[model samples]
Target: MAGISKSFFKAEPGQLVESDGELFKITHLMSISSVLAVNIKTNESVRLHVENLVPISPTEVTEKKYEERLHPDLALFSDDEWAEAQRRFQAIKPLLQNPIRTREDAETIATKHKIHPATLYKWLKLYQDAGHVSSLVPTKRGRKTGTKLLASEQEKIIESAIEDIYLSKQRHKPQDVIEEVLRRSRLAKIPPPHPNTVRNRLAVLSPANTLRRRGFKEAARNKYAPILGQFPGADYPFSVVQIDHTEADIILVDEAHRKPIGRPWLTLAIDVYSRMIAGIYITFEKPSATSVGMCLAQAICPKREYLAEVEVGGEWSVWGVMGTVHTDNAKEFRGTVLERACEEYFIDLQWRPVMLPHFGGHVERLMGTMANEIRKLPGTTFSNPTQRKGYDSEGMSALTIKEFERHIVEFIVNVYHQRVHSQIGMSPKQKWELGVLGDANSSGTGVMPIPADPLRIRLDFMPFFERSVQQYGIQIDGISYYDKVLDPYINAADPDNPKAKRSFLIRRDPRDISKVYFLDPVDQRYVPLPYRNIGYPAMSAWELREVQQTLKTQGMRNVDEHMIFEALDRMRVRIEEAKQKTKAARRQQTRIPLPKLPVVVFSKIHSPADKSMNQNERNFGMAEDDPFAQPIKPFDEISIIR
Candidate 1:
């Protein structure tokens, strides 16, 4: 009200007032024009008045900017850090004297806290609107404005540079490229450009269908340009895991052929909170749910203790639901399967706009790093290595496929991870552990104008019991659950009452009719696989184990209490026997079975009688014991032995 007019339509929010001697010029109005109270000093004693008024002119108005309350050095943050502080701020705001209402208020809060205005706004919005807070921070100021140098010019320069480099197959200096550009411009009647100008132009133009840090950006130039992405220290895991898919070349051995397969798909997820890779999926094809599923499973699955023994500082200490997930707007991702999965997992799929991939730069970078470094293994091929011009998938040159692949995989899992990550300068595994242990928030949802936490994810978020479906209202084990239950929860029962059926919705697997996963409210985790699903659950594992003990107590072990289980037990035993008998020791196994040879005999023929008693006798006399003469002959075929 200091500067604004009383009329609702005439006044603007934050209109500053300037004062002249005879008259007053409205400076600025507070955000809410109706909520102004003025304290005026006619003499020395000031009186407070709640009235419709406008801000006075220059004489009364002064340019006032209080020193941004120096934040606790600990509280100060880069633009990325503001989101988290804001989240904490929202939860703690009720404890503060003022509630946020305007951009100025948010800025003021950021000033006081030594953070970004976007951060404060995100925090305050959650508090005022939904009464819940999110962890995502606002984007940093230095983001790509898309205010790039002219594209046609950029292309012309690149073409000029590449033409020379490709023809010579050598690296060209910046000066050389600039000279070529100038020379061409002169011939073409275009303006001559500076060398630095050409390099700056190149930095802005990232390659199509690829993610690469612009190495040409001179560090000193445009320091205020948007930074890509950042994460606070290992505060929490899964706050905002970024999922993305890109084609990369990884040497995969085809076990069938004992040779390298085609280029592989790289599906990767990075924790925005920790700036760490929570999961990695590498395959030799366009990435699919099968690929994503593997990566996601790794991320959500509990980290085992043996990790510490295998790798240093591998221990993970915390686990739970992440606040939100960021992904690209790919058709496969928009389908019902992924949407339903996120709903069931209590995860929000925050898909970026189509073709606007820089929004997910972190994961994209990880992909580039894995490919660029690992693919350039000793024997790995590139389309234009010396010139850095283009990509060539099938190599014209032959490399030892086996040796190349072995080194590549080994390098990724061990050597690359051991090296410093680009964003945080920490190993991916190390950052990942930090997130899992700390329950920090990392979400873009926090940046929404309104609070997002209180938005109870809709019931239609796949696999929940809907009130419209009756068949969904069946009992499982001892509890009554459904796909959707009627408003009355007609089949619902008291959880405390043993005779009653406790009601809930179920998520049946579309791929397999044999499996159904129940949402267990106790641990906030999914059911371990192979858990039996009854219409009404009889009891938890602890309860079931006790019942088994009781059955032993009653001496009913021989009797088939559950025929279903009894049949399973019998089947299992049979399978085990078959496996044991058919399986033979490696050394004892025969290559092929042999058949016995049939025996056959033929008549013998006798040789003509001859005598060898005398050296030159007219005829050799028939002799029974003559050494030089053939006394008898045996003919025809005979089976040798066996």
Candidate 2:
């Protein structure tokens, strides 16, 4: 399945494909990120994800190295086999549509086709996933259940040898395991199995299990995980989730100062199946791997705790591991950190095709809808300068970051999810329910699996780097992190090269760099490493960066860990001073501050007189009305049931 890689998922309208052995022609792309294909044999139309359709011509598939993508030859099917495939396709076609059918619908169709309702639905799923009519072909039954060519006693001997010799802390070689098995068989006076048969048994053992058992836990986590090649279509809930970033179209204010900071960047993920918002992360920081990771972690885990944290009342039910995360080929999205994290969770990460923006239509549409909602807020820039004409965007800026987050969550869970979508002919929440829980007309595919360890999932996606532990512990970006657990790996050398140090994986949340997680070699658990000198307060990576920049500007030739923390402390003092001055001035101003209708003011002081103005007066000059300073109550709290 060489060409059956991402190239095979390339689809266009009017292309011929085989589904359930029957031929079908792709009609057009659907709004829900799906494609419409009409069955050639029965003239029945069906909606399918592009992955569902297999290439009809043998020439379409090239040789591939991977074993997963199988390009079955449809030309070999006999006339009778093709007719039976057509019959199965027709029987299951109605169940493929949106607003999934009920048990009643399944029973009625099952009776007409002379098939069991359960069997009919199973066939529907097989065809849906493979997109080949061959999926419906009858299996040539031969072997009875639990039947094995070898005697049970011989099988037990082989299993024991594999467990003891192949899967051991000492890491025995394959040849060693086979020799041991043969020796044992001979001692029992039984015929020995072929070397390949023993090798085949070893191969059946899961790669992760084998690696972990052989004391290569790090390798098991990093190297042996599967990377899915094909992008499953947006045919089901969590099938394909798209994420993108945009600078929010409004100015936000600082909590204490009550003055505009700047527009924040919004990282949003939307499930293509039901047009539901899967996850969102908003920050003043530019788009980076951390933002992508945070957004994805939110999407994959439950949102109940998150909703409560944000103080939003409505339910956000769209959470799970998506089949494919479709994103643009930005540098952040292409990073190894994201790629490996997705792989560890069995997620297929697909990039949008070059020069095709339409491939990311769902997230783009959601962004637009969000922008429209943002326009109604107090400090909206309204998407353009023309729209903001005579409007006091900065002067009207009143909402703090927390307040703005509340509004966004309110809009997503309360307004957008509940509103009737024109394209889907139902609210996103309604469609999501139908897909997850099924309706009167169709059987529902249950919800996607929730992560067992939610915190671990979040930590897995955070920024990570590899560093060898030393006597002083690990130093990263001018911070020293240490814990007693690192003592075993201190100054550890690589097994392959004695002179080289072994680099251990360390992950840290950018939001708080006070500690870093060290991947312990002993138990393969993430050990928390706090600052060696814990007196320094916790600070963000962004704050550390700014302090480094300030030090360089002041002509500091050699900066160290202590210098960075000292600079951060000074910066924190400056922020506290600004907050105090703003609060004091508010007590004096009886009249509401006047609104300023402009973006941002960056100017040079022409004279010494201008420069001599106190910092308070300079900052307070840009302040707006007290009413604008108050927290915004944009919408009423709306609670939703699951």
Backbone clash count, each prediction separately? 49, 12
* lDDT (CA) per prediction: 0.41, 0.71
- True lDDT of residue 252, candidate 1: 35
Tens digit of lDDT per residue, candidate 2, span 290-383?
8999999888766766776677896786666776898987888878678766744446788876678788888999899899988889899997
lDDT of 1 by residue, 535-560 (tens): 32222222333345655666664433
Best by lDDT: 2
**lDDT against true structure, model 2:** 0.71
Of candidate 2, the 10-residue stretch with the lowest lDDT total is 1-10
Superposing every Cα of model 2 onto the true structure, what RMSD results? Answer: 20.9
TM-score per prediction, in order, is 0.33, 0.56
